[model samples]
Target: MLNGVSGAGEKPRVLTGDRPTGRLHLGHLVGSLRARVALQESHEVFVLVADVQGLTDHFERPGVLRRHIPEVMLDYLSVGLDPAKVTFVQQSGVPELAELTMYLLNLVTVSKLRQNPTVKTEVAQKGFGAAVPAGFFIYPVAQAADITAFGAQVVPVGEDQLPMLELTREVARRFNLLYGGEVLRAPQALLSASPRLPGLDGNAKMGKSLGNAAYLSDTQAELRRKIMGMFTDPAHLRASDPGRVEGNPVFTYLDAFDPDVARVQALKEHYRAGGLGDVVVKKHLLDTLEAELGPIRERRVGYAQDPQAVMKLLRDGTARGREVAAGTLTRVRAALF
Candidate 1:
């Protein structure tokens, strides 16, 4: 527990999801998707396809966003996340979430939002300068709405996203204090054990905009090309040269994907001792990734072939999510009015 909020011995309500900017990639798989699949066994899980929030930066690409919503859902299904166990909600489908966002927004301030580390970093990265979108700037409050609407006790987030979760806690605490009841449950962060997966180009994080991701939907040949070309130790110019595994994306990926612990350790030792080549290591990684991704790719293809059924599953989940959100909204209304 990141903070003391969830009650002991109870099934904690969980809210964790992604914006539909693009099809999910290996980064998504390693970072949080796998964790969500595991969480569904014991806890109540709600996966929000945050198209509304995706618009913060991608408002200009509405078509792209629309196209990816089903793709994102397909990725979720392909990753062994059972829809029977997990509730999937389209952010815009649940009107209560937007209403909650409007109310929660009143509890936060523009200056406070500007001080948020995650938002500040994104603002600079997006090069928004002085023209940051109003919607983009206040998304933390909207996220708070997403959390409290389901009375989510646990929120899965990365370290970089802790600031956003803190803001959510603040909003919930303020609402409860001002409204005179536990109208909102302050959700705690469930941090992922896996570190951020670096881009194939060796960027610090794999991102859709960076064009360096190996997407879940990538063909085997595509995966091979990306893995083979992945950035590695710049100084290791020959097979006989002792390679620095630290900061090398190849080994970083091996650390993440290769399940054979002894094999990876031996490879690392051999590479450091100057006999292993990048090609050999990359070929190993490619095999490891293919073993994992091949099944996922096949499942995604099966889901993709039946888009209507996928949409039906999403609609059903959205209805269930809205029922939960509506109950929360009713409580909030009683608190406010």
Candidate 2:
């Protein structure tokens, strides 16, 4: 019933977002997308398309970010995120976010940024070593700006983002203490109940860069193919061999995606005891995934047909976001002066 308006009795504000990199995959759905849909019903939600942050990694490929913005929006809508209840903002569209980031950068230090576990892990993964871009290195500050600029009370994120959210809280606290007022509100992390989904290739995380994600927009054939190729217990070479399901990516996925708890537990026991073939287990996973992704794929196709309408939605939402952020910026400036 919330129609994007805040009042004296307005619901608590929740801000969460994605960098416009590519079409969102199942990893996104379980990680944050599903949570966004649920949060909108009870909170004033702002979903940001973080183009500026995306540019930090994809600077040389601006077109990739440009192309994926709408694609990302389509994924949001396909997953049942109603624009009427959720405001979608483009990161670059609101200049105030950048202004706020510039102010916040001074509060955080280079040593502290380098010490962030999430940042350190990413730097090592990307092999940035000593060559990490200044923009990429300092994104935690930008993220803090993103959360505080909206005056968000809750931020939905995965476990990996805990450090980043903590940094944002620190920034808010430092600002309020230094500026001599409670102008910036510190946001709390709303961690996802779901664990990270493993990639088809058996990686600890499903990622687009890893090329192992089964995208939400994937066709039935695509989903089936990915499931069939999913990593299972390598030692379970034959149907007669007892399989280990603990680290097996296939069972992990089934546990994450399948809603039938009893069925999944039975399947796990069957596979552990022996006689269940990988193909049979994969087929079950494929069926479970198809049921969930089919409706989403259909919805995505429908939304993609009217690309301009999607763009307009982003424009309208970004305008609303700018108005709200501008008000926050006004208070921030007053405290600074």
Candidate 3:
């Protein structure tokens, strides 16, 4: 239900959201959050706290999500997203999105949803298999509502998430053609520039469930402890032995954190050639990461103490967002009627 801005513009509108699963972690920072913070200055940005979407997976844990909404907002604030620049809102707060979803659902086939690469992967990963809940199965349709509701022209996403964005575009196109009018904006994917950061345990991806994430709220002591125990070259048992860097998680962390790429390159050579131990590499990475995350951690602590202030920010954002979304919904309803 976004209003006023639909006429036409040179600057593209962008919509992105994150589920309130837990605290924002280092992976979130290096990946989407950094890009979002930067894009707010240039693009028309709408940041959504996807509590409604979170219910697709955590249907029984509504209370957990209720608790984490403020935490997610604080994380966004701590990462430098300005409230004045970006429109922040909760998905559940916008009932128009759900209304649009119901209309679009009839346009999408069950087979099509089943073929969604991201949905397929998630179903297997979550062990839902054939028992995937109806709501979870229709998440892409809901996402399409989110994108089209804002008339989002661009959606920033990781490479793996391309399928979902493509699905949104498809939904938009189909809705427009079916209704014989261009009521929705067909969104395109804006892929992230940074590579995915690996988990501290050397897992392929950092995730909260894996227990390998270094959270943004991590204390100096916690950061140090996590880095000290980080996974590195297993073959390099001795200081004199040549360590492998291809699969080394420490090298991956360096790739994400180390500002001096040349210095990290030299260290990689030293480790591979021999006489460099995993501990030495880990210590260097720890220092580099601490330097980068120090300010963010401090800001998070300050925000954590003032929960009411964070809630107020979300309330203000939701109010602004409702105005825009409600406007869009009005136009959409008029088109259908």
Candidate 4:
């Protein structure tokens, strides 16, 4: 159970989702998905494949997304997220989420929606400009429905997503206060502790759109090659030149991957002082990443071979999730009545 909250007997309910825009990359693994696996033992968890939300922005590429659902499920199963322990459901399957969104939207302001950092950032990132779809403009309200429909008390998200979660909480508060009913639960954010993993190209963030990500299913050779070709201290033209470690992404990978923190710390100091070469650091990163990802890749291959099994798992979980969402909708409707 989560500490420091009232209702000690009531287990913390967590709501989390992934936009199935593409195969999940390494950044997804280290950040939120790994935390979800660990939280399952203590909290009631719902993991959503937000295909509907993916369509909000990727409306033009629905066919591409339709093909990636199975691939996304494979990535989730390969990461050891047990379907039995976690409720793994598809967003489109839960009609209640959409129905609830319609009601919740009336309670929130257009200005509030425009202020959402996620909506603003995504619009700029995707160059939606004035051409933003109505659905894309109102996704935070949809997310609020996803959180409240499950009656989730906690939401796990990265720092960049905090504003979105805050909007969800505000929507819940406004609904409860206006309706004079406590039917909707205000969910709080549980920010991830893991450092944001940078991209192989040394970009500030790893993402599919940026073409800087390492997919979870990448093979050992692919992983080795990507890491070997990673951006390092550009100013350090010579191996003997004093490399800057502060912004060096190779060192950032080390900080995220290397189990031997002390050893990695010493390597960072040596690199900064003018001895460590990019090849040496890249080789070390490759070895450490392979040690962690090799097993996951093997597991992914085994699950991928029997695609039916993975689909069955997702289908079964989605059925169970529908039952829960339906029950919650009943209560919400009765309260509104």
After superposing all C-alphas onto the true structure, candidate 4 shows an RMSD in angstroms of 2.6
- For candidate 2, the per-residue lDDT at 167 reads 97
- Candidates in order, TM-scores: namely 0.96, 0.97, 0.96, 0.95
In Å, residue 157's CA in model 2 sits off its true spot by 1.8
Count of backbone collisions in candidate 2: 0
Backbone N/Cα/C clashes per model: 0, 0, 7, 0
Root-mean-square deviation of each candidate, in angstroms?
2.5, 2.2, 1.7, 2.6
Where is model 3 more than 4 Å wrong at Cα? Answer: 1-10
Q: How well is each residue in 266-334 modelled by candidate 3, as lDDT tens digits?
A: 999999999998888889989998887888877778888989888887888788777777777777788
Query: How does residue 174 of candidate 1 score in lDDT?
Result: 90
Per-residue lDDT of 1-337 in model 1, one digit per residue for the tens?
2122247776788999999999899999999988998999989889999999999988888988899998899999999999888989999899998898999988988899999999999999999989999999999999998888888998999999999999999998998899897778887899889999999998998999899999999999999999999999999999999999888989889999999999999999999999889999999999999999999999999998989999999999999988888988988899999
Single out the weakest 10-residue window by summed lDDT for candidate 4: 1-10
Worst window of 10 by summed lDDT in candidate 3: 1-10
**Each candidate's lDDT (Cα)?**
0.91, 0.90, 0.86, 0.85
